[model samples]
Target: MDEPLVRWDWIARNWDNGSPLAIRTLLENHVVMAFAPVLFGLLLALPIGLACARWRLLYQPATAVMNIVYAMPSLALFSILLSVTGLTQTTVIIPLTLFSLAVLIPAVVDGMTSVPDHVRQSAVAMGFRPLRRLLQVELPIATPVVLAGVRVATVASISLVSVGALIGQGGLGALFTDGWQRQFYTPIIVGIALIVLLAVGADLVLIALQRLLTPWSRARRSA
Candidate 1:
């Protein structure tokens, strides 16, 4: 592989230098197609996985589907869906969401399972209803672990959105394709660097959010 040529000056210029229209379009598309699916997957999977953990019968089916989809290689998933969905943004969204579910389900399940039974028993003894108990007692204790899973999912989605570029769905991946096609290394390098920045930045933001949401965990850490 003749490594792509990276021109720092050129990359810096393009990093935030595109026409206003282009910059806005990229931001809009990224949020709608890329961010939405991952967030949707998390929302759907968290409840399902938590419920499944408490109810064994649901576990087999949910985990089975997640296992099968997660086992599919990213490239294969893309290729197969591209054939059916015809290389549109939906093709990218579907597979990435599936990938997110696989990761998130396990995380949520593990977090929920780790909650001490004594806590649940106490909640029940206090006459707390099932949903109320889960919301107030179980979920609070599991916050740190569940947020760790979300951190993993957010980073993974950021990287995978690069793959969305192949389908002509715009994002940082556009830079990589442009570089490869034109043999201009700057775009590729810039794309990778920005992607890294996005992931790291997201992780930091999530960590802060997790600390804010799980105040007890933060207090425990300081103790």
Candidate 2:
């Protein structure tokens, strides 16, 4: 505890001007590294997920493949990518993108499927074209469930980005390696604590966003 305090103090003292390892830079890096992949993955998976929802045949196979990829060890995944992408951020981002896609795809499917059958029938009765209904009706109705999946992806991305430190690109994870190398406990503890805080903070922010966007969901809850 005291050690972490000392580290935090050191971090604060250097906060304003700590070159590459500045706490601010690290925090920003952590957020960027973690979120970039998730955003990319989510975008990629949204259509894929929707397709699966439409075509049941694609659903199970896609889920199975993603699950297999997700089951692979993170380090092994990184190492394998390293062989091709080398030490660039691409190595880190690609794996994480796949991971985020795995988490988001099922959630997207769930969200889409959760739109009650009656809702779809009503949309069809109202002359809502397929595209418009999907864009306006389905997406809005599915927002809460989709957001829940996004929360999972976000948290997983944040936690896994630390593993990048192994390949010299870990954001907040770099501090952990540095601390261990120097036999210091502060950076390690601080890194872990901050990572958890970051994950929780992001999750809470997403939850708030979900509430703000889905007024109908709140209305339903109140009723």
Q: How does each model score on TM-score?
A: 0.85, 0.92
The ten-residue window of minimal lDDT in model 2 covers 1-10
- Candidate 2 lDDT, 58-143, residue by residue in tens: 99999999999999888999889898999877888999999999989999999999999999999999999999999999989988
Question: Which candidate wins on TM-score?
Answer: 2
Alpha-carbon lDDT of model 2: 0.89
What value of lDDT does candidate 1 attain over all alpha carbons?
Answer: 0.79
Instruction: Give lDDT per model, in order.
Output: 0.79, 0.89
For model 2 the local lDDT of residue 96 reads 93
| RMSD list, candidates in order | 3.3, 2.1
**TM value for model 1:** 0.85
Distance from true position, residue 181, model 2, in Å?
Answer: 1.5
